[model samples]
Target: MRDHLPPGLPPDPFADDPSDPSAALDSIEPAQPLDAAERLAVEEDLADLAVYEALLARRGVRGLVVVCDDCQQDHYHDWDMLRANLLQLLVEGTVRPHEPAVDPSPDAYVTWEYCRGYADAMMNVVEDD
Candidate 1:
């Protein structure tokens, strides 16, 4: 039988990878749980989100609407719901097991333009005051 081996073959993909499972685990980055500062920052952001949510709610709005970067759709997620989604995304790399729709009133959900205008109006009022 004649040999059909190539003179020079490409390197194997798993050649560098550890063969022993223990060694492989050693190379893997242990899930360093979120640091205290990171957790606090995330919580702070959540709190700010609650403020935005409250503003919307105060105007008879049910929830804050956001455009999904992945879906590119205007998703109406409320304060806690959005927080939950964000947490899930952080943990699972996505909002898996997807949540049921908790649609906020469309009329209540204002655009960024409206919020900015409202802020400007408030600023004007404050300056006058």
Candidate 2:
């Protein structure tokens, strides 16, 4: 192969060879600064997380396991981890790296939608009573 790459350009491993099996890694940028309204919303979410932890942990709910759209796999975050992430966003305007639960059981984790629905149902029951 003739050297066509620019002076300082690193050659693409698969430039001419098409069977390298290397996946392109996506570059993740830092989160943008939160506006006043967004800041308020994050604060509210943080408060709601506290309530969720209090109510759900008693029911044996460990935490949430999210299937990241980017990674296309499940990531487990315990209640404390979720709280820390939200707090970091509010304070630093950026999320820290994923710190998933260690050897988390898929059975112990619930989706965010499930938690929302559960909370809604509980609220309705409380209102009815």
Candidate 3:
């Protein structure tokens, strides 16, 4: 048995474990930058969202006030809910179908119009191709 082993080697650290040892460590590269127009739109979106988040944090605004584009009414969503909605829209290119009633819970959400306006302002500033 001694002669069968190789030199300058160590036993497997997790030989008894089923998982890959390297799974505990991983590295990722930074995301690629957006193009000029894309960069501006993204920056604008981020800036507006940041402000909304800050408002939520500082003013204890509870939830943002947003106007719905589909139904022409206000839809209220809390931070978690609003985040979920934003992520959903980002993935799907459109918001969920339903429109919540106006005058939602005191801390539910803001109108979509505000989000659109904020995003639009950024887009508007960009030079047309």
Question: Taking the tens digit of each residue's C-alpha lDDT, what string does model 2 give over 56-119?
Answer: 8998888888888788989988887788678778876876454456688888788878887888
Among all candidates shown, the one with the greatest lDDT:
2
Per-residue C-alpha lDDT of model 3 across residues 86-113, encoded as one tens digit per residue: 5444443433333344555655344446
Which should have the higher TM-score, number 2 or number 3? Answer: 2
- The candidate scoring highest on TM-score is 2
Give the range where candidate 3 is weakest over 10 consecutive residues by summed lDDT. 1-10
* Global fold similarity of model 3 (TM-score): 0.40
Question: Which tens-of-lDDT digit does each residue in 1-129 have in candidate 1?
Answer: 222222222223344456733454456554555666766666765665665565556767555566777789787655566676556444534343334345446676665456556656767898999
Backbone clashes in model 2: 0
Prediction 1 TM-score vs. true: 0.47
Estimate candidate 2's alpha-carbon lDDT, on a 0 to 1 scale.
0.74
TM-scores of all models? 0.47, 0.70, 0.40
Query: What order do candidates take by lDDT, descending?
Result: 2, 1, 3
- Considering summed lDDT, which 10 consecutive residues are worst modelled in model 2? 2-11
